[model samples]
Target: MRRKKLFKMAEVLTFENVFRDPTVIFGKWKEFFGNDNDIVLEVGCGRGEYVIGLSEVYPERNFVGLEMKGSRIWPGAKKMLAEERKNVSFINTMVKNVFDFFGEGELSEIWVTFPDPQPKPCRAMKRLISPRHLEMYKKLLKKGGKLHFKTDNTMLFDYGVEVVGADKDFEVEVVEYDLYSTEDRADLAEAKLVQTYYEGKFSALGEKIKYLRAKI
Candidate 1:
């Protein structure tokens, strides 16, 4: 393994965070944060740009970046630890196994920032915003909790809007086909200012970042 990869194994929460017995973690999130603050999740949190950056913006709530790749999760995890951020954490796990960690009604919000669009017609189920993930999130989130999805892929953006719109269980709160167009919505506007590494690359190539906020 590389030096930085070694560092990630030693410093951040990896597979070790999950005990061999998954049942032991039932409803233990508040204890992990050492408080009952509202927890925010960033699924597929690549490089943890949204997790670390937004955790700073909203200190009262706790943030957890869920990513499978240790290398991709290393930078933000290290930075958060160095800064001594109490409200932020990361987990090395696949997005599909989210239920293995969190309990029902335990999460406040979920942010799926620039997730894989899975644009291929045959890969619709692979998209992060697919119904399978939505059903999973619905069980974890508190009543009226929010799920935010932002992406540069037009196909993914439209798919997410259609999925959430058709689903009566969730209400689409804010729909911004072009997130950077205006600072109209305070929360969404604040989010736009913090771009992830992938987002920056896409922005430079003149891609219009799309956004949608859904309440469940």
Candidate 2:
């Protein structure tokens, strides 16, 4: 099993849609995707469930999955290749280096689905929704762009709402402590369009999904 995974990890970068060299596509995303369509990013996209789903739902918009683990990227890259999805791409890198691959206001939307939450106090800054990360996201997002955050962690959810709501630069458009509690609305429809791998596990364990939508 380990050998198979290692082989897949090594093969991840070989896919036509997977890019490890930021210089090759940085500031040339439209050329990379061969279209001027808006680009959306899914941070820490494990196995590429959300990105893949969104790509199917919104074919007009390009989708990129940013995940650090090459092994974690293997399955998604392989599946996308098999399906011949032209609008999807994968970047194997940490979120801190996002600027290396994208220019300011380059992305139309961003998604943070089931991130680690960086629960430790000392690792607070490591959280995807942390203030520093929010700044990075704000810079990368185009004017009128939006970011969607979904998680099952109560503490992280509250922290995101508090910090994002308090920030004067951003507007917290919607906050749902239990996303599945009601029928999906047009405002937050994408959050329920697909179930991510971890989201499925948490939902099966009777955990209520928390969702936050903020405009930058």
Candidate 3:
């Protein structure tokens, strides 16, 4: 059986509507979690499944999902709107400009789930987990904040481990070679939390999943 929709997913919590006009997000943050500290951000939030699931599991923490394509984001946004989940919000924007939406040391956790592999050597620069993106993540995540990543591509996972390892601020740990292997399935399911549309399709065809966790 299919699971119930965890929370109302939002389509567009625009900058102008949420942050641009405000001097500080503290107030809005408080409104979501009357004095809580477990805020998390998800980049490239696709259909909002992971963010919404997280919000449902940890109601005290505020969750924000960022996505560029409105067409790809609408279902999750509509779910957020339908559920009226005050703790969750969706930003309709490109991942490359995430800093514009949040301030330094503002998040306690971040997730980069199933990002495009960009397998070509020359196209590697376009991959989401590159050195440049890690720098951007460092700006927003608090010291010791964690980055949890999962993908189906082994090349991308290996590349991410290499890049994050070379960065002084990030401590790479909990690298998994095959996330969905029978012995690792339970752990992967609990840690990864939710799956995206593409992930669902891939899993149906018996594709293996890979995952990693790192601290920044």
Q: Best by TM-score, which number?
A: 2
Rank the candidate models, highest TM-score first.
2, 1, 3
Ranking by lDDT: 2, 1, 3
The number of residue pairs in model 1 that clash at the backbone is: 0
Candidate 1 lDDT over residue span 57-116, tens digit each:
888899888887777877777677667788887777788778888878889999988988
Cα lDDT tens digits, model 3, 142-164, are 98999988888889989998998
| Model 2: worst 10 consecutive residues (lDDT sum) | 182-191
lDDT of 1: 0.81
Candidate number that wins on TM-score, 2 or 3? 2
* lDDT of every model, 2 decimals: 0.81, 0.91, 0.74
Top model number, lDDT: 2
RMSD of each: 2.5, 1.2, 5.8
Distance (Å) between predicted and true CA of 42, model 3? 0.8
